[model samples]
Target: MYTQCPDCRTVFSLDASVLAHARGAVICGNCETLFDALDTLAEQLPPEPFRLLPGHTRSEEAPKLEVAIYRPREDVPVAVAEAPAAPAFTPGFVQDRRAARKLPRRWPWVVTCLSLALLLAAQVAWAKRDVLISDPTIGAWLRQACISLGCRLPLVRDVHRLHLVARDVQAHPSVPGALMISATVRNDAPFTQPYPVVSLTLSDADGHRLAMRRLHPSEYLDDAAVLRAGLAPGASAALLIEVADPGNRAVAFEFGFE
Candidate 1:
């Protein structure tokens, strides 16, 4: 039997024996609320016309049985330890079956998650060994000896190893006071990729609208063989990025290896 936990909105499967043996009351596993399962089901009652006064029944007429539908109870105890005691719910509070169970605030989990994210990001950034674009420009070089997910997978792509950098930028290069971008891409995928995939996106401060591009190594880099540009295991390269107008540097540049 399937029972919905009004408190948590979770559906739990009930064992056949348990369902069969369940008494009038059923308790929610999540919120620990109790309900009278039978009290909530509507049963046919005598119809208005079918119910007659005790003395008014006429033997001449065919015997009638009352059959009517009724809305179940408007309010059922969230829990009822004893018939005379009030339920767990406060009076006048709107009760929602879905509210029977609720997730914990998760403040600790959230903090832990954010902490882990920062830690991983820090680790990635640390292991990054790439360029950091503080100005408003785009395109910079990033290199890693080799990225390992620390585990094995069917495809190497499953262990995605990529580097990314960003900043607020404009589509057309501005001059003097105008902003412009210069990018250099180098591939370090250990395995020589005849072509290294390259892409860049420029956005505003709010991370709203901007421009992006994806080009082949020949299109995105100074050298044709990106994988050849790959550092020999522990090798590194520096791609200089200078703004024409040092003031409003273009947004930022991003690089990745797969």
Candidate 2:
């Protein structure tokens, strides 16, 4: 009979009497560890092709006993490593970060709104330019703006700012059938103003208009003055008017700045 040590997996030969005496308990010779021999014991059978004959007269033979010691392979113990813990998330911290990122996105819309507001304000100012110029403070502001742009504002058509004086009409001594007329137009405005259009009307005895004429600045201003060289504040200009007499029946005439 054969036995194996459970601790060292070492095999040893033993008599049946020795196993009976130890009662299936023995110490490993190689490892010196105590273990039960019966726990490691295995039972085996003969080969299939060999058998005993039925009626054969043969001398008695001692029984051949064979024992095989089976030692199971040992299992190796493995150590398992634990994984690292993940950080916990907080709702307030996450939301604050998201809000910080979204704040920059609003800037473009803000800039666009401001630009639109400025454009609207400029349009309203241009549309109300006439009304703005009527006030002294706003007029000064507008005049400064015009000066910066190298431009001029058109004169207001306020008849109260002008006066007509020194009016006369006489027959032309050199040109017969024609009349020589003269007048003085004055400006009483506080600021320089553009030349006004002159309107002349001839009336008959029946108070019906016979002839009418309107003269523009370019036509009447034959002096060295250009359109931009407007009349000075509180200044006057002499108008030398000439026209053909309508007839003996024409008795009245009118001249004014339109």
**Candidate whose lDDT is highest:** 2
User: Per-residue lDDT tens digits of candidate 1, residues 77-160?
Assistant: 655634556557644434543454464567899899999999998787545322321111211122121233342111112113
In angstroms, the error of model 2 at 175 is 3.1
What are the Cα lDDT values of the candidates? Answer: 0.43, 0.74
Clashes of each: 20, 0
Q: What TM-score, over all chains together, does every model reach?
A: 0.25, 0.53
Give lDDT tens digits, candidate 2, residues 111-185.
999999999998997788666765678878888899999998766555567788678888887898998788888
User: In model 2, which runs have C-alpha deviations exceeding 4 angstroms?
Assistant: 1-100, 148-151, 204-208, 223-225
Worst 10 residues of 2 by lDDT: 50-59
In model 2, state the lDDT of residue 90: 75
Best by the TM-score measure: 2
TM-score of 1: 0.25
